[model samples]
Target chain A: MRLMSKPHSARELTGLLKAPTGIVGFDDVTLGGLPAGRPTLICGAAGCGKTLFGITFLVNGATLCDEPGVFMTFEERPEDLEANFRSLGYDLNGLAAAGKLIVDHVRVERSEIEEAGEYDLEGLFVRLGFAVDRIGAKRVVLDTIESLFAGFTDQAILRAELRRLFGWLKERGLTAVITGERGEGQLTRHGLEEYVSDCVILLDNRVEDQIATRRLRVVKYRGSSHGTNEFPFLIDEDGISVLPITAPRRNLAVCNEIVSSGIPGLDAMIRNGGFYRGSTILVSGVSGTGKTTMASHFVNAACLRGERCTFFSFEESAEEICRNARSVGLDLHAHVAAGLLRFEWARPSLYGLEMHLARMQRDIETFKPAVVVIDAISAFRGPAGDVQSILLRTVDLLKSSGITAMFTSLRSGASRDEGTDHGLSSIMDSWIKLVDVEENGERNRILYLIKSRGTSHSNQLREFRMTDRGIELIDAYIGPEGVLTGTARITQEARDRAAADQRERESNRRQRQFARRREAVRRQIEELEAALQAEEDEEAMLLGEDELRDATLKSDQAARAIRRRAAE
Target chain B: MTSDAERLDEGAQEAGEDAGHYYLRLYVAGHTTKSTLALNNLKRVCETHLAGRYEIEVIDLRENPQLAAGDQILAIPTLVRRLPQPLKRIIGDLSNTEKVLVGLDIRPKVACP
Candidate 1:
């Protein structure tokens, strides 16, 4: 049956009406930009990196867009602020000295203040206006406005003042950043600041399994289109960097060049060559089924072809792998010394998944290797959250870079029909199954090619032995008792054949004994008759019955010899 | 000519007696556009209506910055009425005169026919 596809519909799009927030690289997610010349409140718990984000917005504006900024801090002094940003390689003090930045601190002490019936925010406006006019500051940050709540008891007055402050900023066409402490069930401590501002951002700091991760999400942005996903952010020596996990990716052309499997006789079954270059191959099997052996052989073959290869060893250390491969006639130490192979071992939980991916990308970009091997992909499945997505993206990345990718996965049981843990079979270009079958009282490893795209591979599962010289594929076993299992089968078969031969030998002996006994009986009868005749002759004349007697005696002697032979 | 205490008492009594007038204190960091505009607007309103009774104090926070504690001033160009009970605060340059006058509870006198 044929299926019908749906049609597309067009809708009217309303663009942003507020002043644009001159934040670099941030516009890529915010479509056009943030509301222009309007207050945007950024509220989060303390140490959630809210302050860093505020500083980043201002620094980015000053440096990238040539827009001057005004930072009005209520908690930290200007010196402390400058020192904090200095570690990020941002010269905030220099920018202030150069007249491109303005910093103002409003010191409010609750102990020194008296409550009155009516109040005004005229002093704050004057300071803000002075800073704005001094450098023509287009951006402003009022960090932790909640500090005012501690000095005042009247929420009504504070709310009115906040509304007016936002209105004033809008009137002056100056984009502003107002920061506040987050409150339970509310966006900010005052709860009215979010409504007064044009945009709101929430920053969260979470620790899962002793690993800290910071995330930022745009709660609301009026008159602007912004990404709503929670993007992971990092705070290092270089300030704040947000990684948009769901950003649109660029499509790259994939190459399909056939490459050898690095093992003789195995490549002949696979399309007269082997796996295509830039394709991902999954080597799945139970424990001790020669998965690592096959991967090592592939690496050795790649090295033999003078191609640079990288092996990411997660299950085994580099030295252990090298030492173990020695039994299989694979010497990796020489290849490593010759700069043909590199082995890197790291724990999957060493960092966040994105950080690990970024590190891998950096390494791949730097090395530009022709082949990459991730020994045992099962080790990376759990730590990376969703294994399928990570593997898919990794395959895409390697394929686009024209690098052959090989991964090994350990199955759970002895049955070769077991599926992979991460469900990578659907995407991998080739799936090789290795099994340990019990045959003839010995456990033998058998290798089978399940599928290989763009190539013809051997369909038969052949017996393979690990000898001192390396892996050797023996002829398939053909027997009436079917495939043998373990050494007991072979021992039992030998015992049954030996018993049958013994019974046949016993029957032949009985037949020969019967024939000899029958001949002996006939000879005995002749001797008896001769003896009787000799006796009669002796009685007649004591002498001359000799011929008959002699003949009978000779016959008796022959009979006696035959009887002895029969008895023996 | 008078002691400081006496002068303060006299000013307080006079401020107390003027119930119809709105006593306003503008806390500003320095001479800035918002501060100037707020001052000019308040002066114009007082002169036109409560010319004789109104008292407006312009306090520059930078000069006597410690005075900001007397009234909680979070932003500059903040206009506070101290004479009125349950003090009111209006933030901005007082550009919206109608809203600012209404917010300050100051109404112009109407002549009877």
Candidate 2:
């Protein structure tokens, strides 16, 4: 963020002024832009965009910097150049008509000319000076000055004339761009780099594995400190935009707002009820593990919340994705028609990884979506390291823009490793890994919250199923046999129910037997008491008969017996 | 088509039409030594070969700098053959007479003289 905020102010401190190139990310890479009022040599091989680079500089200078420019071509004609750069949206005719540019073609044919004696390039100087004065141009571009070598046969005279040309350009205080053809070992075939001593940039178009990537590097910037690394650049319909490798480190703004992940079951896993707004989430899994399903759910949820979403799909077309989402009860088509969701689909082999990233970045910038979903980043063809670095930059862009981004990576193997195949799990704020568990003659999808940086998340392996309704996260069976899903979980649950039933039945039988024994003991005690009472009664009767025999002699004994009976 | 020597023979060259007449334009920056030498060499060559049939026009670019873009000039002391079916240019001071004649397509007819 603090790189080059005010270039004018920076000039005061560094004593070197810069002219902004107006190319995206290019100014930052150069700490501002090319040194102002000086010549910069841009060297590259054939068809490597040397002319385009020079044209972009001139066009941008004319339209953006309020500075008129002179484009002197040593090869192609003005009409051919105009037609070639028309696709890039540069109106050469209009600019020239507006007096903001001048196109001068320096045609030199060797077959029609003979050098009989000494001659200087005074004619070239006069023409260039006239054009520059006509437009009061501040910038000048000599597209591939190396063509002079093919046109002229005198090396000594040509070299001396070139040196004088550069000196003349500098004396006029014009910021110049002189493109050169790359030599075998030197920066330029004629070593023009030795003459232009202010700045030197190299453009390279390299093809590896049949995929071409364009890169730009600032080899030397005299009296200025600039980024020294080779940066990936793209030339599309909008013109050139360079992607600097270094991501915004600590300057990204932190957000506390949370958005749901669509599935309540999954949202419940996160401590904040969902992912942080503007945080990068990676959903990695093997084939048929519902990576796209999870990403779609997020998109659906974002759209439902009245937030715009951009879904970038590398594997499936928009129609196919909408159809699949319909089966899962997510009407992505409705959101799309509502203008809340946009789907961009491109094949993985369409372009280089950096190009894809640049295009996606451009789309995001234009759409200004609150949420973005990249379905299957693994489909991008490149080395793991390159893909990871590109993803790192992508994530940085999203985070710095405060846009919630979700990227799905297709893991080739169902390994237990929590990292993505490209090793992007580290830079992600949240990483959810999905794997299919095969047990009980069936395979079931399970999700594991591998890493969540800013929020607490469930570490359990959540069993999820994609039914016709949607993806539902069910409680995985956690037992001594480890986490089980699908039929294994169902069978374990049934076995647990039967064990509970048998334990209840055995307790009921034991209680009944104990009650029967207690009832028998009570009845035996009652019988023994009855026998004792009978024996007491018989003894009392015998005493009463002996008393009656005595009652014949005395009536008082009967009265005494009656009184005794009354007392008892 | 009038050279310095042909101007002397203008009365005799007046009968000749525009065709079969050599028209040469020499482009020079200033009155430099090389431009002077190229101009003198051309006059000598015309007198020796076509004489009254050749015409030479000397243009000094130092006065009218913008005129340099007319013929797409990059070198000083450049001689352009304007007449005949095909046009040709010879850069540098015309010190080499044979090469200048070949460049101007004045060789085959030089044998007649």
Candidate 3:
């Protein structure tokens, strides 16, 4: 009957009334939050952030939701709890002073306490009721209520009392969070799960390969659809934040506008002149392959356009990156000074991949950058599956926010395949593979445009050179010897030039020899014509003398004929 | 037994007036059966061992539940010995006399060599 009852608000569609926890990415995973006005059990081992989770929930409820909450810590003193939460910037004392929160430390010291006869925990109920009623609290947190087991010897009485207490809390219509220590095989050491069955969240901190990652999972949410995946959460100075990688889907606003890739040559390789405005570009290469330099160029171009950019560097410090960028003729420090560029650097080993993503997401949210550059995603070295999954989520977050992102991955060895070691090339809108072309006993960098979605790009590998001026993408020489780079290309080009010069010189010599012979033949023909003219003149003279008289030739012929006829 | 108790009281009084005096506070939720039993047992023990040398302060949490926080009370029928240098707390109805005497440090002082 209870299961059949509709516990949701009348205005909302069929489901329980949810309470938004105001934690980053937590609400999306829980479909909203824990079941409202109901008890949710949070079980975890020691040092797994069970207490912090409860405190954060209560604090968020009081501060953000405007709902007063009561935090009854069974293990920590009120002052100690306040001191611990202060590191997260949570002013518990201030909230308590404002009457928005009530922290009641239920100290049960077994050493000083002696059990003489039968008893019940009515005093606890009275104190809790008083605190709750004083602040009109809508949320209650019983942190590690299992500590009561250490104080009481009568397990039966404690169980009965706890069941009654849960019922009383439910009747009061208060949202409650009960934390318990992890058991050997059960959800909680004392089986608190049997009492608070409406919702259950499990917090875990696991260390693998010497890297610890905190994860939160909603094991069950009665009457609600929730994300069953183990969401990675981070507890930093700001507080606990869960990364709901599965919630942000691929349906993001696609922009047609393109942004330059900083290097003019690199931009020219893409058909659109640049990458799409909100696209994810993966630049994979081995060590010292000019990946970071290319990313610097991109960030510089974005900053030059007066657009904000965030550069997350996991391998190097901001100063080191800025200094390195300066070597490539990019003044990133100036952009940083101009407030157009922000460099965030952290060691990948300091946190798990998901934490880095969550921090990056938060940075993007606060800075509202138009472009983001992750200098080397490979610095987050771990299982390929985890690295790729986090990268996919990071890309999704950037795409959903309509921010252009460039991720540089470090490929191991000389693998020239299109696939990145992290297997993140598929989700990328554009993938640029950088490799070392070892030729002529020297290594040179070459960049290939592996794929660019929705845009045509040059498939040819360009000799990626980090010139003093900037990056230069020269068209690689595709000779019979395959692709040539470095000094090998230069030597081949010089040899071709010398051979062309020799061919031109031979043709010039042949042309000169032919012109000289033709001139000699023309002179000979002219001399012969002169001689023939002289001979003809002489003949004419002789004829004219013989027939004077024969009246100068042809006239002489007519005159001769007339004379002949007269003589006959 | 009366003479021995008087001599022990004189020796405790010589040290300080508060030394021989017992300040006991019982925290309970109204006049429940366990609360009453605990109160009666505590009074009987005090009268027999520390008659006229003890003071009992009964705190009915139902009348003023806010007072429970001061003593860090959680269980019903709780007795707190406030006057001793190191305070002690005994929970549950004070029906077990031997355990109560040991918990309140009354039997050890009487049995001292």
Candidate 4:
């Protein structure tokens, strides 16, 4: 045996090629579901719809592929299986009667079998082989093989028999679905089955927050590029449908027609027109920087312009968005009521990224929105894995549909650079960076037109103030100290202006004091001169009088000696 | 197929209700030590405390080869519980006893004897 092994150079490729399971929409998740001519194991706990899933595979093969199938049930009676599927609109009885489907129930009871002896499974093989040949079955399902183990106690013989049975099935090149009951720490009760099967799919039924959900995941597929995420699958009347959680197809065609950004000033900043009609725009900023408000403004603007818009809000409720938009001076309620704007609030993990994209695609195709706004794409980054790939695919999908897409991402710390968050910066055709600059003591929001592809954009950071009138992008605040930081800059500038006014007032006060002193001195001089003139007049009068007296007394002895001086 | 007297002696020797002791036999072909270690370890364990309760019957197919047909053994070193009613057989050597006891339906003692 050792000499015969020789590493078996004839390699059997198990996992690269996928056989299309002719189930509509099922191939999207399994990536061309199940391998043909190989046995696949479907393992799950009780009531996880493992049987329903298996039956769907058979029914789908018979109806869609025009291929006959055989379903062997160890647990349920054949009549019971037929009746249960009838509600789902499957005509199993008709198919069986028409020789399109063959269903067999192998009854095994441990109480009746006393001998644990070796017996050829040739009877079972013969039955299965005959059924396959009779219906020309391309697909076969064996529901639950654990009953065989329960019926027989000889583990040594049973193990070899199981190996032989699997080998026999594979040798026949029959594509088969084998269901197994999940065991603790083991893929199945007899764990050897997983080793023999070409593919293994795990179905899970869980109740989270009272909402029961059935999820399907490909545990192992020997030869195909199968999606590895646990996808939510619905088992309705039509059978099982798995939601594929991956990026939708991206279309790279750039749209040139300009559209309003909702804010007239904002539109002016990003060229004289606005953002391209179908390009993706990133509006990133810190908390309370009006990212959602901006998204709402865009939605409202689009609606007012008579274009349909979808707002996928991750954080806020639709009611809150509408109510808050009014405070920002945007009335979105009218647009919502008018059916121009649709608000869809979703938790990022509502499904995997691919399922989210598919739902969005469905909505977009149905509503045909001209603009799609994912309130903040960052919320989706956790489950979406790689950020750049998701954003690129999303942008491509939107652009391909000619729908303008706007995504808001919240940046951590103080950096306003677009390059901060991984590779998301590269995928955006336009980047609107909102920064909360701290200058002096207050915080002020500043919006900058970072990059707008194919259009001239304002390089200056415009100060945007949110008020009752809405978001107003004030003229770029250019001060002596350059662009101010936060709200403190505005207060500091105000303080400086006040201090300069105080200095000018002090100088005027000194000049007034000097002029007042000079005027008072001149007045005193004039008064003194008047008084001197009056005194001189008086002296002249007295002199005149003395002269008159002297003249009278000059004869009278030159009298009046002052008169004497005057007379002298 | 066997006499009632022989069946009685076999039943009396095997009927120690001590759940911890297991009478195990690993059927294998030849001097493969995987089988020898399984036999030696089982005997060493029986000598320690289950000297009375446990018995290991190691069947070598190279010598008493037809004995393999009695148990219908396929894989080597297949540990078989001869005393237990729902006779349990585990295909490897008793490398993992937790699986062995669970497979053999032996209620494990809180502390090994």
Candidate 5:
């Protein structure tokens, strides 16, 4: 019961009760959603999804928030509404069967009945009152009540009755959603906007440059402060979702957690181990510039760190992305199989940019992934002006949620977008631009970091090569013709090798000459020492013979002297 | 489902209630000055030429707004002739008696230019 119970007041209460619509990010913009138990008027032009938004509110009230709802439609048939909402997972029929919801279609045909005298709208009141009592609904939705005005000719009576109906709903204290058709000058065709003094929401469907976008704006909210900006909304299978353009960017909680950019070399280029956690990474390049490859590295790294990652590929299918990543040694398929990585692929040409954003937010909220990758945002075709809003909301949502996001964009030319016009390049915490440089009759991918906020990044244009072994980053060989890559890089390397070989050969020849000179000098010294030794030996022999002759003479003299002394 | 708050008083059912072969229906939005003026002007024209021969039905558009589509009443204070083999729709307050007479074909004299 607690699981399905209405969420307690998450924001500070100021004596106003707020009912959350459960629409994506709507409560954030509305401050706390619609004023609780008060009739809120939703008006829009045709095909603006006014009725669908009302239905989503009622369905969410009945299903998620455990508030039984009553859906009284004047425009669409009950069967048609049920069938249309089935795609959104709202089982209107089942809810009606379970006595949790009431779906009543008011059908008043002119030919079938006649009036003769004065009367009031007692019959309709009875029908609506009966349905409300039957379902015990706390939330009510009167979808497109303005259609009843077209049937009635007396504006005075219809306006009076509409005001009475709103007052009665408020008296009942039921959260009611009243949808109306937009008029030229007035908010509603019947001028029934008087009753919407509590809250008024306007939905607009605009088409510019062949792209259709649905925007929701809160024209007025009496009791609470609400977003005044036009928020882009999307209608998908789940239902209507509004993307609030202003995502509490200023007060967003920042962390010191460092996350990898997937490439070790690029990580080294950044100040931290990689990028700041929950930072937005913009990877832009021309076609086949390995933008997706770099994105894959980021995803692969996140998965390696045991963090959940979701990759949204607009141009490639899951299978194609898997196969392509495999070619570059990124095992994304295994990560997907392990449930650490999620892949969502959609063709950008098929859906509006708002729907893509809603689907992306839905995926993020459900997957609760730590990292999200949007590959190739340039392919998203829309009004060049409107694309900025979509991109801003996307980045803002991810950033506020503390989810690190990597967005890859394809460039039409050699220059990179500074994101000034597109609102993308400006808010990014880091930007890595991949460019394809033609060298030696081949295109080589070059990775360059244009900017990294709060981090010191390498300014070198790293030579990035994708091979079966994996993507390898090598120090660029700057030759006389500038930084080289591919075969030209190899050629520069070979030329450097030949130059080193020549220097080594020259040094070896000089050493050999020195060794030969030393050998010749040693032979000369040996011949001189032999001549000097021969001269010294001859002198020593002569001196020794002279000494011997002297010694013999002295001995004979001594003998003669001794014989004379003995005779005396 | 269609029972309450509707009074369908047909000439055949209400006998002797302004006995006439012609059936007239006047549609008005509540009791406004325009609606009262149109009703008074229409009765004066009908009584003059079709006294006790026509049955007039006053239908309040505010009571049964759905009935407007049946008679194709675009503007309030409209007079519709349902009988005499031809359908005629006249709109406005019916202030000009001669014009109303000519419009209803009450007399050829009033109808002539």
Candidate 6:
């Protein structure tokens, strides 16, 4: 945010008195560019791209920045320089024809040339003036200023002439790049930096762990606040681009956008539907934990959303990956055919990590993809610094351009933490860890949402299965006893059902016993009723016998009959 | 190429074996006074001790200064023995005949001590 709001006044303060090199990513570090209208000394050992730097600066100034340049080389011929640069896609001859650039090859054969008395390099000055005037050039490049010294017999005069030459370049109002050979104790072979002191850039090419990295640093830049650290640079077909050693300034405008995870129910794990747009994600897991499958899902999802996606596969070939995805019913090949998906397959051992990064950056810039997937970033095995730099530049390039990137890495040893070998996990906006859990003689894949920035996410471990349809995150089996996986989960489900049936049968037996007791009570009530009726009948018969015995007794019998009737 | 280099080496060996046939290379900046004097003095000494049995090559460093690196030449008007098995260099205008002879690895006849 601070970089985005960099005060305009600050820019003008640092930028007013400078000449932009027009080399990609270099001008920013030089506080605008090289010191304007002054000679800058560039010294390096042989084969360290010293000449290439000078020529590129001139070519860029002429073609891209609309500043014509004059290039005077001391060693190689003009045709050789033109041919060499032609392969780098810079047309020196074409630029010369267009009157924008001039290449003068200064040949100094001592046998052919003579050094007369009382000379001060007026011939060289005249030639340079002619070339500069012809092209109306504002930039000049002297590839290896020492070749001229080798022809002259007097060192005192030669060094004095060199100092005068630099002063003349400034007086002529030209931004000049002077190349020199690195010496043992001093900066240059002849200590040329002492003569040209306006600015100095040091280029170093060293091989570490059998891998080569080229770095550049500003030794001295007069009157400017410039980056002093050594920045690694890339030399490719398109020329040179020095990647600053510092982390990218966070100035990108963030958007509240999301892209879904192709697997169903997976989006819910990351709370706000999916990962934050233009964020870096680290997908770390053990071997065969479906890390590659997860990457396929992300790439496929981006493609399905009609957004372009590029897959950098260091592990499997495109064919092998497509076949693996097809087994899970993901049509990766269809997306490739639809021009929505692109695969960059290369072996990690082929080049240094920086070269791989340069290639990746070039591809991403050309493809303009919305998402990029690196299948197994751990495949780049090198010095720890190399690995860290690879991740830094990759992350910076993706996030600053509003492109989300997913990097998959394989975790070795028994450590299940998502900590990367290069410690890049700390910079990740979201990290998803996959583990293979073994229980009851079966192994199941489970994934965890370790952390996601700017969004809520589930911390619960989700048991995932790679079915024929696709990758599915099923609910973890929480049983009465414990959380189970694979065959143990199935066995636990069967045991629970049997226990429910046993409780149902025990309740039925108790209800049957209550019904039997009710039947016995009903039988006893019936017997009591019958006994009461018999007693009443006996009394009636006795009363009838007494009435027949005498007339006088009739009244008693009638009374007994009336009593019996009342009882009935 | 190996046979050619061997033949050249053998030829140098033959020249050293030939008595009084000295092979010399004189380094000079140009046709200056010091350079001409050094050449004349060397020719006179070689003719007296090894008359008509010596060869000399004068190399002007000013005209072909690149050759100065091949012989590791430092000062102008220096004399180098080209064909001797063990080469020798004598600086200056070769003014003393006795010293020049001694520097050329030849013992000068000590007259009276």
TM-score of chain A of each: 0.62, 0.77, 0.80, 0.58, 0.78, 0.74
Writing each residue's lDDT as its tens digit, candidate 2 over A1-568 gives 1122245335554688888888888898989998888889999988788899889899999999999999999999999999998988999999999999999999989898888888999999988998999899999999878888998999999999998898888789899999999998999998998788778999998888787878899998876888998887888888888877555666766889999999999999988899989888999888889999899999999999999999999999999999998899999999999999999998878778877887788788789999999998888877878888887778888888899999999877736666555777778888898888876789999898887788788888899988778889998999997787898898888998899889989988898888988988988888888998899999999999998878775887777899999999
Go through the candidates in order and give each one's C-alpha lDDT.
0.72, 0.86, 0.87, 0.73, 0.78, 0.80
- For model 1, the docking class works out as incorrect
Compute the interface RMSD for candidate 6.
12.3
DockQ of all candidate complexes: 0.11, 0.61, 0.68, 0.02, 0.03, 0.02
Report the C-alpha lDDT of model 6 over B38-112, residue by residue, as the tens digit. Answer: 889989989887677678989876666545544535445667775554556666678777768777756544543
Give the higher-lDDT candidate: 1 or 4. 4
Off by over 4 Å in 2: A1-14, A251-254, A269-271, A317-320, A331-368, A380-397, A413-420, A426-429, A437-443, A450-469, A474-568, B1-19, B63-67, B108-113
Docking category of candidate 4:
incorrect
Per-residue lDDT over A124-236 for candidate 4, one digit per residue giving the tens place of the 0 to 100 score: 55557667877889888889877778866676766666777777776787788888888899888778554454688888877643445677888876656678888767665
Candidate 5: pairs in clash: A419-A425, B19-B53, B20-B53, B20-B54
What's each prediction's TM-score?
A: 0.57, 0.78, 0.82, 0.52, 0.69, 0.65
Interface RMSD, all candidates in order, equals 8.2, 0.9, 0.6, 11.3, 10.3, 12.3
> Candidate 1 residues A1-568, lDDT tens each?
0011011001112644443343323554566555666678788888987777778888878887788998888889889989888988879888998888977777776644444224456567666777787798988888877787786666777767777777788789787878878888898877855445457878777666655557778887755568998766666665665555443243755566677886766787776588887788889888998888888888888999899988988788899989888899999899999998998776766555554454455556667889988887776644444667677667766777878888898888744466855768888888888888764556777777888987777787766667767776654554676654335444556765797789889998999999999999999999999999988877876455676799899999999999999999
Models ranked on lDDT: 3, 2, 6, 5, 4, 1
What's the DockQ of model 3?
0.68
Stretch of 10 with least lDDT, candidate 6 chain A:
A1-10
Candidate 4 positional error at A109, Å = 7.6
Q: What is the TM-score of chain B alone in each candidate?
A: 0.74, 0.78, 0.80, 0.66, 0.77, 0.81
The CAPRI quality class of candidate 3 comes to medium
TM-score of chain A of 3: 0.80
